[model samples]
Target: MNAFLKFMKRNYKIVALVVLLAGALFGFTMIPGQKENDPDKDKLLIELLTYVIEKGHYNPAAIDDTFSKGVYKDYLENIDPSKRFFTQADINEFSKYETQLDDQINNRDLSFFYLTYGRLQQRIKEANSFYKDILAKPFDFKADESFNTDYEKMPFAKDDAELRDRWRKQLKLSVLSSVADKEKMQDAPAEDKLKDKEKGFSDEKALEAKPGADVNKTKANGEKKSFTELEKEARESTLKSLNDYFDFVGDLKQEEWFSIYMNAIAERFDPHTYYFAPDDKDKFDTSMRGSLEGIGARLQKKNDFVEISELIPGGPAWRGKELEQGDLIMKVAQGKDQPVDISGMRLDDVVKKIKGPKGTEVRLTVKKVDGSVKTIAITREVVEIEETYAKSSIVKKGGKTYGVIYLPKFYIDFENQDNRDAAKDVAAEVDHLKAQGVDGIVMDLRDNGGGSLKTVVDIAGLFIEKGPVVQVRSRAEDGKPSDKPEVLTDNDPKVHYDGPLVVLINNFSASASEIFAAAIQDYNRGLILGSKQSYGKGTVQNIIDLNRFVRGSTFGNLGALKTTTQKFYRINGGSTQREGVKSDIIMPDKYSYIEIGERDSDNALPWDKIAQAPYKPFKNNFAPAIANSKKRIAESAEFKLMDENAKFLSERKDDNNYSLNIDKFKADAAKIEVAAKKFKALGKYNSNLTFDALPYEKEKFKNDPALAEKKKDWYESLGKDAYVNEALNVLDDLQPKGGKTASTEAKKETRIKTR
Candidate 1:
């Protein structure tokens, strides 16, 4: 049976949505009971349901049914807000289940509820059994033969069961080691050793080699201590270290175990999504808001050590030039001069040491890439979103300059009193580019995950005169439906730019990016070009404060729930959910192995259509312009090399298994190395520089060459990066000239069809 259905069947009674209206009518308005059926639950649930139905994976027809069932299933499986601190009697009450919960749910029988309650009781009984098992076991290392350095790596103990056994043995060994250490310390004759040292017998070698004192060969009671005996002592020392680690973990309480379980479940959803306890919510919110007062760098714990991953451009670290990606941070000091070594420390504890109030200084001692050590001081400050804002550069091609704006992400500072948003930044860029007499502008939204919905609509409005950008449909309580496009809300009548424009996107472009691209395509305002499609995350989420759902309490529930709320659609009637915006000119990308864009995600909103908003097309007679652009792109040597690299990667991905023979691996590695060398040569030519020979250092070449080749191919692939060349060619075609209109019109049509 499906996991969700099975859970629902067992706990239908407890999991059932008790209508808030019903609870209010019953006059159950006291603490726990009143809070359990508060109006906020219904409101939040409805809002989330509506959003999921409109923007979630299921078709509109299946959305309502799926969401209603799914939500109930979720509640049934995990809604035991009270920590399971049940008595022995509760465990006994839950042990009599005969049938699986699914059968009961499907049959709508009361037996299902009883069985579910019984199951919970049975789990508590199992917990008690586990406790007794631990208590009854002998806390001695000798009986547990698994106490060795290689215990964790042994093949016999591969699974969780074996690992647990190993942990138990290690714990016992740790206790024995501690006892031995105390015994050795107590027996130490401090006065005798001090007297011997004063008498010129201090050196361990000199004392052992004393005349008629062959200590190495001597044995107590005529028995020799062999080499094997010495080896055993060394092994015991290593095992003692392992035991110490296990002892610490084994001491956690049952409540901590439950918390760990909850955290693990949240991690299973996605890397970005997390389930935060009430205490962690504030920190989570602060991080997401991007206003944290700390040295602006993202770090990750790798191999039990923290390493810098990305430096937010213009942030403290970036400005100071003290930290770089791949640098290992060994220690962190907050205000105090004494530095604390963070090696092998928990990531949370390290973060606490680094993060502090604005204007406070933090010192980091990092190991640089060149084997040099450096101590750097950084002052924590509020990270400004403007530091990551969209900026444009003018690229001159064939004497014609074109504007290229790089938008990293659609960021919005919602908490700021003056919201200087992405849309505004982009508009300002467009104005700047237009004033420079640029022939055209290229809006690069590659790798942009998206941000505010309001910002997207505003950005889309800048290009189009005035029209609806997208449509949103939300679930209604009475099983009704509502839909409307998000139209341009820019009150200012002044236009930013009225020139040719092109949008560059890839698989990483999503949500707000999709909205903007779809709008431009619908209006035929400019060309959309890049990889196959964009990420199709079209649903919006509203954060519901659980405090509102708790009745008759000032503190209320301490957790907030983020629920899906609405689905966004393009004004042209098509939903950009599963069917993300498809570019006019497709490019090749290395991430083809990765299932990206909307349709790839499970449980994502499906594509649908609604009534199209009326809008006039931005007619441009630039057919010959595109054909001319394509011809240039096809002939570029840089593009050809990139295509070869992409083909190699695609071929590599298709091969399921690699040859196990060492010789075969080496040969393959060599061929890859040569290909990479060729790709680098191509880059050198593009920049008009002397190409250096391949760096064949064993460590560097082993993996670097393969990675370099992949990058080279990604850029060269036709559908992947034709935009850059196309943009350059497009600029050339748009140059004002005394040319024949008829020929230009024909060329434009041909290019459009081909693209």
Candidate 2:
């Protein structure tokens, strides 16, 4: 049996007895009081409340403020008929409340529920009104364009006149859409006019093969095509494109329209969470499982254009080496054919056009960063990019080597049993590094958004002796703790390494990553170094089956609900809520310009504490190590240069407004170039004077080779890592012996000379 089951059996008997007595008293009142009741109202309230409570995973008492007791009971019956959380005996004891349900209803205060319900109802009504208006007089696409361009400001238009003016513009656009459709019908060829059939003429070829077409006046040396013929062909091609768009829109269903609206609202919440329709559920599952057949690129809409944001490192696109960041996708074709123009298209429509079954060919016409155009062909396939996985490299400095492991994200292949798990893989890496005889290790978890909870516990266990990893507390339903702290295991008692360790985290480090870092800090197992704090996300969500809460006889699928079920607290009782893990040493980052972490987010859960768990601390003192590191970094030329670059980036972020004039742009570019050169020169003068400037040239820098090299060096330096350098210095200070090594003495001399 599980620990939860054990707890329930041990304490539930007393709680059930108390609830039974209350139910009996409540039931007695139902017999005496007589008043007319709206049976439908009671039933409706119960249905809504029950579905929400069981699936919502909130406190049962919350229902009192949002619904009546009788309604609550109805919801309980529908939601938990099998009494998985509460036994049948407990339910029988509570049946007495059914008799006095009306009396308990009088005590209910559902203000919050009413408000939320009212808002939902209002949105539905507004949507209905818009639908009816559109049906009566369809949207005019042309006029809507003007208003849509400034639609963001419409919300703050101040007066009815301004709002009406904006609406008028929108109405005009709707009329234009209708006009465009009419024009398309008149211009389309007889066979191609049908929505199902494609136009016979290739868009590009049609422009060259029109009536009165002019043959080239000259050869490739100085060729010229007939302008009049080309113009006519272009017009015909554009009309066909419009016809295709109309046909696509006409096929959309009412549910699809609503989905588009709902998606807009969900997007406003965040980029990740989405409301998937039944048809999209399969793809959703695949994405979460980290397996999908596509071009292996993450795309997003920016400034009304679909742009490729990230090329999955070992995916088809990355392997092809043609697709790159800032490349504008103008069109997508299934094979070696004239591509359909996707410019000025909706993001979803573009996505639909690109996604297809595995082994299918997809061609992308791309506009490169250098104003060059090229067509890249890629065969869709499952992309497993190991670049995102934890990878280790050795950094040798002053005769000692440190293993530098970079964990970009806490990823796992839950769907593929044969795949290597992240925690297991990382452990193996640690073992390998240990065998290589490295003196210390630097686990870089920067920008890791975290993943599987089980994996996090396993990773933490690798650093500490076995003990309770984290405590989870679910809101009590009937005045008692719902579950106890689940103690995770590391089974293997052997320590991977007994050497010094340093964990590097940043503002982007979150969830399971934060948990691992916190565990290490709480146990004093390693040196924590990086930004001020990490992304604080301490809530746990579980997928609940909605079929259990249906009102009818047969189970109807309403989709699964991922609701927050519990709060996770550190074993020491502190919650990683608004306050994520704090670093022992801070590093300057360009992202510092933007507000990051849970404290910066609205509606973030507050930090709290529970109770401490027993655990032993790792015997390492790092204060002196950090102090000495600070002294070294303050005088290091490379460190100073990095700091200057960080400040410049921050300034550029703050002053983003730029002139479009060629002269002004050139001048600004020149200024930036000068600054970069000075920063590089400083690095050369201070440390590694023999380091060549050729490696840091503009052409090399453009490809980010310098940044990549620096990052690698930073990780390898271990105690010499500017941040880790400080950490090691602090450790030295905390130790009985202070900085006494030849390397330390040499660094001290360099610091004095630089100062």
What do the candidate models score in CA lDDT, each in turn? 0.50, 0.50
- Per-residue C-alpha lDDT of model 2 across residues 330-425, encoded as one tens digit per residue: 666664343565643555667776777888777776644333344567788776554556666654445555566767666676689678688887
* Residue 540 shift from truth in candidate 2, angstroms: 2.0
Give per-model TM-scores: 0.55, 0.55
RMSD to truth, every model = 16.3, 15.4
lDDT per residue as tens, model 1, 489-601: 33444446656678898776888889888888877777777777887777655544434433454324345434344567787777787778888766555444445445653
Q: Each model's number of backbone clashes?
A: 22, 31
Q: Once superposed on the true structure, which residue ranges of model 1 sit more than 4 Å away at CA?
A: 1-276, 289-385, 411-419, 479-493, 553-556, 621-726, 734-755
